[model samples]
Target: MSGRAADRWAETRAPSLAEIEALADAAFAALPEEFRTLCAGVRIHVDDFPDEETLTEMGCESEFDLLGLFRGVGLAQSGEVVSGQMPNAVWLYRRPLLDYWAEHDETLGHLVTHVLVHEIGHHFGLSDDDMAGIEAAADDITPSEA
Candidate 1:
């Protein structure tokens, strides 16, 4: 490798939980306003990997098997907010995401955005096709529109 390439590689480190959370925020900000409005109260969390219980519940053979997850009631499953209810939440698995990113041809930011949107899709209880359409539409949003 070239001297500069090697130097750059040496300085690179995996993103921390806070950095991953920041990436998620930027990604959410980049989505269309309408969608953002719909995602008003969802919480996002970043962790190195899914917890042992989550892995077991999801039937994941390895921590790397899952990149992210969503928890809480979807719009389709909601009637009205109850006083004692927990808020909706999305969990981003950093180690798994980084592992996946290493094996794929995409920017980390782009991958984060993709995962965040998919989690939000779960919050809305959208079908795969419906989520795909929303993602396509999100891509179509221009700077001015955003």
Candidate 2:
């Protein structure tokens, strides 16, 4: 509703990686302060699709099988950062997420936020209560497609 008229969709294109990253940033920023604090130094990365290595690692037969992923030690495990160690990261697969958005009624922002929270929650070893809070925060931030 914010962009051009509906008749102009054919001239438009899918969201670029930069646009997706922006959406992720907005979604992340909308999270609760406490949750955001826990994710300090965590980087969010976006790619059109998961690489072959990632697909195999995730045991996915198709590229679209995974929407997002969290890679790194959970907060409940290790606290100290070792030299040259990779920082905690969340990967959002753009193409798959787009495909999913097309099939469902959820807004792109909401889906992205959902995937983000799931990954971050996994990183922090969040409890059910924490996850519920995350979901609520996401809902508050994302506008409904409906």
Best by TM-score, which number?
Answer: 2
Worst 10 residues of 2 by lDDT: 1-10
**For residues 68-94, what per-residue lDDT tens digits would candidate 1 score against the true structure?**
999888887873567888888899999
Q: State model 1's lDDT.
A: 0.85
* TM-scores, each model vs. reference: 0.87, 0.88
The lDDT values for all models are 0.85, 0.88
Scored by lDDT, model 2 comes in at 0.88
Cα displacement (Å) at residue 93, model 1 = 0.5
Candidate 1: list runs displaced more than 4 Å.
137-146
